[model samples]
Target: MNFEYSDRSKALQEKLTAFMQEHIYPLERAYDDFVHANEWQVFPELERLKQLAKDAGLWNLFLPEEYGEFSEGLTNLEYAPLAAIMGKVYWASQVFNCSAPDTGNMEVLAKYGTPEQQDKWLKPLMNGEIRSGFMMTEPEVASSDATNIATSIVRDGDEYVINGRKWWTTGAMNPNTKVFIVMGKTDPNAARHVQQSMIIVPADAEGLKILRPLRVFGTHESPEGHAEIELDNVRVPASNLLVGEGAGFKIAQGRLGPGRIHHCMRLIGAAERALEMMCKRVTQRSTFGKDLSQYSSIRQEIAKSRCEIEQARLLTLAAADKIDRFGIKEAKDLIAMIKIVVPQMACTVVDRAIQIHGGLGVCQDTPLAMFWIYGRSIRIADGPDEVHMYQLGRNTIKSFN
Candidate 1:
């Protein structure tokens, strides 16, 4: 497939890069400090930065052009490099309203929600007036197979009752997260994939409780912390059910395909930044009368990181291009390949950068530590690496047969 980015994509890449350098890079350290010191509260400057992003026309870059008015008129292929630029800083995506859970949630709403449902939630979300959560994983289940999701959504006249516990519900802890797209069983006896359904539940609904903020590598990941939430008999209007009772799995697959592309590209950007840092650090330091850059070992690490980053980036771009030209089903293998490859590559590249940074690596002094954490954590997020590999291996064997 031709992977050359269009002139439009190249123009966006240049504009986004300049925006990041001018505004995001200067405030990176302050943003980190504020989030750490404040805990669930947003860094005060984020709203202003977001307005700047909107004014600069970089907002909602993740939504695909197929969504018409809701989208920025960019294809998945066109959005990939822009996402990579935003990925260099963990919080930068939020500035452009391109962060996940939200991005996935928005896609689901745009694709599946009824007109009224979209009016109520999607508009606020797209306008950056509200945030959202995707509640699917559970503490007791091996959620890699989503059919194992045991949350129950039972119908009752005018409303549906929801009872379940969800952990790693990203964005639930944010004060601005006003809604959740929750997945649960609506018909236990239905066919395997048809048993589950997704419904919208207001974050403030009665009987819903925020159990606690779950930490990743001991950091709160504040402002949008991953949360453990208990939905005890939570109820919402029956109108909130998306598509139909058996459509959860279908909706989820559609939502995740593009989201995975966004995540992988961002990971590549993080890896590129780490490698850049590693190269810079080596040149500025010395050991035993020899520069760190002069050592073959250091040079080898740099070379390996560069090669791995390029490989992952190319693979992710190929996946994006496929998703643009073909449906998600046709691009499934490539999607699974990136899901299996990118995070691991990012983890390895960031680890080498951390090693080069020495003590400063593990500490908050450099973004290297957070980059490593993001790359490593993502191996388990979305779908875990093992699940993708298992599916890909099966697909490969079937192709041969």
Candidate 2:
């Protein structure tokens, strides 16, 4: 029941907060401007910021201790607050090499890849020399039930031929995305979950085409845009298959457990920032001859937001602690709880913040609009709220009986 962070975690939180204040916050406007104007190009100052973060020993903080050499030795519980800090700024995680798709992909390679596969892909990803994507959700299927994915990976002599169309491939549009961990059906007749397998395909492999960039709320989410891709007869060596046939489901569960924690914690941070902005804004402006902060409705909204943020933060930490002490399998219910709760909480909180800010909230002048988009988008990402609710309800009923 102890939810207090360890001294190590508290120390890292301070350091990460200071780093954000000193570097990240100052460049927020400039970063947004460059990414919007350049489309698919890295921000000009990104590499320099990355170098500074690395020099500060703030890189790869997402990898837990079980990852061995690749990890920063922090458990999931320890990493939660640091993730919250990075979440305050949308792109802040990448500067420290702790961003997604990459984080999940690295864990896959570290845990399941053959030595050769690790040397080829994992190494580059860990060093931040390249980026990657996870291709699992399909445009034609009810992707929430990953078992519904219809991508086909057929064996062809010394290689595997992949054929499918995937959308919401988060990092696919990034120029530096050098590889993808693709999920496809290798044995359609195998048991429900075992039909699928995960394989690595190079970004430039033949028959791999970038169909288009998908937008969230009309924004391209520049640099690392979500993409719809066509993989037609894309071939890669047999060695690229992770672990073995019938392992994609297992790998995906492992990847998503921690990934959800990261997402929820970041949403908590975004909501916190929104509340701060809302509070600051209400005091500085007056409507109808009185400060907006003095209005009963505004005060109530602010209070509700604070209460919601704290609840979500605590729930996410509980999930993180459960994972650190037990494992993803044992932590499943808590994971589902946080996943079902945090994003919705964030959406409500951020929406209130937007309402309080009035016109500026919908515009790019403040990050509230973007924060709201992220919160709303996450409600469907990773396995939508309804899916988690279904599973959690089933688990709860079974436990009570």
The local distance difference test score of model 2 is: 0.93
- Over 1-401, each residue of candidate 1 has an lDDT whose tens digit, in order, gives 87888999999999999999999999999999999999889989999999999999999989999999999999999999999999999889999999998999999999999999999999999999999999999999999999999999999999999999999999988989999999999999999999999999999999999999999999989989999999999989999999999899999899999999999999999999999999899999999999899999999999999999999989998999888898899999999999999999999999999999899898988898888889899999998999999999999999999
TM-score of 1: 0.99
Would you estimate the TM-scores of all the predictions?
A: 0.99, 0.99
> Where does candidate 1 clash, by residue pair?
none
**Deviation in Å, model 1, residue 202 alpha carbon:** 0.6
lDDT of 2 by residue, 188-282 (tens): 99999999999999999999999999999999999999999999889899988998889999999999999999989999999999999999999
Local distance difference test, candidate 1: 0.94
Worst 10 residues of 1 by lDDT: 364-373
Go through the candidates in order and give the clash count of each. 0, 0
The CA lDDT of each predicted structure is 0.94, 0.93
